[model samples]
Target: MKAPFFLFSIVLLSILSSCGSNKELQERAPAQFNEVYYSQTENGLNLYIPVAVIQENRVKLESVYFRGMHSALNLDAEKPNLYVASFATGKGDKIMHEDPKEEYGNKAPQAPKESPFKIESDEAILVFKQNEKTKYYKLTGIEERN
Candidate 1:
């Protein structure tokens, strides 16, 4: 009888300790961004913009899509700190790559022909607005995935 009681008390203590540890872990986790804008093109391109990026004004886009291809106009910002542009089609979403010479020939790099959104920073605030209402998100540092 004594041995059985001792084992039951140990199990209860272990369960309580695990529950406390889980709560602590959740509190330490980073906060997630809540704002997001979902825009799609007539062809198939889809763009998802975070409100933090707009508040930070890191993006400057003229149109969402042009000739069935997603445009990366805001990517032309000069001396941008950390600008990330992502787009998706039927395949999947992908981060836009900035390759000056690869995409363009010897001629000077020109902005995309069409754009719908623009991102610019004024006093560390993102200046982005659209005709339609969109959700807002919290700004957080970029995380690299392995």
Candidate 2:
């Protein structure tokens, strides 16, 4: 009777110890990060980029509103052409754009309107097409965790 009970207890203890802890997972996944959070509109834009250095505790958050974005956000005034880009600790994000005007010092690649910049990770880059006729905005945001 005692032998079987001893073996079962040993097995249970081993299984419990072998199970990984949260801290260990975090250490193993040092670079693992996500966009975490983002929100934007015609009025303003918000982004959160967690620093790999800070790992899980710190993040960089920023929000910017173009000079004329307010009017467009409110549908009460005129807007101008605009563009934006960003990078973070998460997977990554990219915003490719196409235009008659060259941007990003010529290295910027022109993208097809059918498929706008694809943001698939922690880093992201976006371009705003604003003009006297600018009327609508395509807002994008991604939140991820693992």
Q: Which candidate's TM-score is highest?
A: 1
| Predicted candidate 2 versus true structure: per-residue lDDT over 13-55, tens digit per residue | 8888886331111112222333435444333343433323422
lDDT of 1 by residue, 46-71 (tens): 23333233333432323333222344
Give the count of colliding residue pairs in each prediction: 16, 11
Best by lDDT: 1
Question: lDDT for each of the candidates?
Answer: 0.34, 0.32
- Return the lDDT, model 1, position 44: 39
Q: Give the TM-score of candidate 2.
A: 0.19
The lDDT, on a scale of 0 to 1, for candidate 2 is 0.32
